[model samples]
Target: MTIFLALVVGGLFGFVLDRIGVTNPSIMGRMHALMNLAVMKTILLAIGVGSILMFGGQMVGLVDVGHMSVKTAYIGVFVGGLLLGTGWAVSGYCPGTGLSSAAGGRRDALYFIAGGLLGAAAYMVTYPSVKAMGLLEKIGGGKVTIGTVPGSGYDGLTGLPGDVLGIVLGLVFVVVAFALPERPRKGEPVPVAAE
Candidate 1:
């Protein structure tokens, strides 16, 4: 039942991605180049709203903290994030977008997916050596949060309430999304919307 629900939710999410034109690599490229900001705004808005709902739900006892899984901080995580950012900029598709694009009949996204699978395989092959190099060593206390939440077992780096902090950050993201312009400059050519 859980798997079925996940499939349904994932399919809906992918449909939303396609509708938003994120399945188009050109749209993603323009986003990275700062020639188009609709994607960025949409992403920011989604994150902001999601954060608010999640944290607020937790505070109201509607959401359980047990469902949260925070990855332990390590050097490798940061390195991987940099690599992912570079890949997104170069390929114009991140993992989720790549999958959605492929579903939407994009040939380029299939290539991106293949490359990602190869990269993952390479990582698996090198995992033993990478671990030996201490890149996976936990830092700043494993599985720590930025702020404390009542009833949550994870350690917090600060005394502030996690729910409050989350809501504040969400509000900030929402404001920034609204404040951002379509193009950085007035004279720049308007990017062609894929849909």
Candidate 2:
């Protein structure tokens, strides 16, 4: 049942991604170039709403706080994030978008997928060596949250209530998403039309 639900959800998500034009590498390129902000606005809105729902549900006991998993912060994680961001900008596809693009019949996304797989394999092969570099050493009190969440086992960096903080941050994202212009005001680039 869980697998079935996941498939259904994944299908819906892919449909949404395609409908929003994220499956197009050109649209993604324009976004990275700071010429278009439709994708950025959508992303912020999604994150805002999701954060609000998750934290609100947790506060109301509708969601299980115990189900939350936090990864330990390490230097390697930051470095990996930078690499991932660079790859996304260059290839115009993050993991989710690459999969969605391929599923939507974009041949170029297949190359992106292949490259990602190769990168992952390389990481696996070098795991031992990477670990030896001390990049995996935990930082920021390891696995701590930004604010204390009631019933969560992890420590927090601040005494602020996590649920409230989450809701506030979510609202801020929502506001910023609405505030962003779809195109840069100065020297506007050609508009991205649907393919």
Candidate 3:
């Protein structure tokens, strides 16, 4: 039953992403360039709502917090993050979104998909050396969260949880959404059609 619910909810999420043109390369590219904040704003909204619900559930004891993934906060961590941001700006898509766009029949999305696959393949081929040399686990660190580990008898953040921060942050996005004015894309003259 839990798995079933997860599938249904996941499908709805994908549907929303597709409907919102998140699968579009142009939109994602603009976001990477910092010209469009829609993607970031949407992400914050989702995170905010999800965190609120999860924390709310924990409060009522409807669900228990689970173990978090291991932390790897070494130098490589920041380097990888910056590289990802740079690549996203240059290529206009994250791995998953690039694949999504490619599947949706966008040509430029193909480049992103290709790069992602190449990176994955490279990782697989170098995995042995990476692990042997400790390069992979170099940045592995603490849990690094506001809450206690599971079974420690302490619930995750209660009221004013991390989600509340997201909620507040999300409001900033909402405000910007209204404040920003839309403009035509580059090389797309507003009078092109009329001319």
Candidate 4:
């Protein structure tokens, strides 16, 4: 049942991603170039809505606090994030978008997936050495959230109440997403592939 639910949810998510034109590498490239804001706006809106729902549910005891997990901050995490961003900008696909694009029949996306798997395999092969170097060690002693939630187990970086902070941030994101211009900047050349 859990696997079935996962497949259903994953399929729906991929469908939505494809419908939003994110499956197109050119659209993603234009977003990185700052010539288009559609992808950024879409991402921000999704984040805003997700944050509101998750935090609000937690506050109301609808969300299972016991099931929530936060990754501990560490130097390797920052390095990994930088690498991931670089890959996303260069390939125009993050893991989720890459899979969605592949499912949509993009050949380049298949290559991206292959490269990602190779990277992951390399990481696995080097895991022992990486762990010995202390790269896997958690920094700051423990896991943390950006805001305080009374029973969430994560120590908050900020003193603000978690749900309140989440809602405020979510609203800000939503506002910024709405304020962003949807049209490409004047004089920017549209890619032939995107058309």
Per-model TM-score on C-alpha atoms: 0.91, 0.91, 0.67, 0.88
Writing each residue's lDDT as its tens digit, candidate 1 over 100-156 gives 889888898899999999999999999999999999999888888888767778888
Tens digit per residue, CA lDDT, model 2, 8-54: 99888989989988888888988888888899899899999988998
Candidate 4, residues 29-124, lDDT tens digits: the string is 889888888888999999999889888888888998777788888878988899998999999999988988998899999999999999999999
lDDT of 3 by residue, 1-195 (tens): 999988998777667877777887667766665556666667655665665665555556675655324364455567678989888777767776777777778798887777788988997898797668655554323334344434434333333344344345556655655565444244453333423
Give the Cα RMSD of candidate 4. 2.2
lDDT of 3 at 99: 70
Give candidate 2 misplaced runs (Cα > 4 Å).
Answer: 188-195
> Which runs of model 1 end up more than 4 angstroms from their true locations?
188-195
Per-candidate Cα lDDT values, in order, are 0.88, 0.90, 0.62, 0.87
Candidate 3 ranges beyond 4 A from true positions:
1-7, 67-71, 128-141, 147-195
Write down the RMSD of all candidates, one decimal each: 2.2, 2.0, 5.2, 2.2
Model 1 TM-score on a 0 to 1 scale: 0.91
Clashing pairs in 2: none
What's model 2's lDDT at 82? 96
Clash statistics: count for each candidate: 0, 0, 1, 0
Arrange candidates by lDDT, highest first: which order?
A: 2, 1, 4, 3
